[model samples]
Target: MKAFIVAVVAAIGLAVAAMYALTSNQRFAYQAFATTGARVSEPGTNLVGEKWTGDPNTNDKSESAHGKATGEPSHPKRS
Candidate 1:
């Protein structure tokens, strides 16, 4: 029982250490947002908490076709 407890504690400690090491780097711990304004789940809210207008499905097909015709990569608005 004592051995099992020690093993579990060691595992938890190692996990915590690994997490700390991974997040300690500036690259990993990047703060992209300046303020915590609104939730993205709310209506009209984008990823950056900015007001998003227009329908997401309404992508301009003409622009994509034009790009393709010009030998450029056709960037579709869909994810």
Candidate 2:
């Protein structure tokens, strides 16, 4: 009887896990599994044609900034 009960419990847990995996919500396991979504020029290798320069739209010279380069001041004009 005890063995049968344990088996039933295990089956239920497995079913719940399967349902979770099928959910649309992105989870840690799914994100970590994919290193990069960008297409690769060659299979089994990660090589880029050119290094990323800076955003053309932004005045900031840095490669990455907090927000988009809208060419506008973030703060409002002071009185």
- Please give the CA lDDT of all the candidate structures: 0.40, 0.42
Q: Give stretches of model 2 more than 4 Å off.
A: 25-79
lDDT tens per residue, model 2, 1-79: 9999999999999999988888636433323353454222221111221122333333234455333223332343397
Residue 27 CA displacement from its true place in model 2, Å? 13
Please name the candidate that would achieve the greatest TM-score relative to the true structure: 1
- Would you give me the overall lDDT of model 2? 0.42
**Candidate 1: tens digits of C-alpha lDDT, residues 45-76:** 22322112354223233344211112232343
Error of 2 at 2 (Å): 0.8
Off by over 4 Å in 1: 26-79
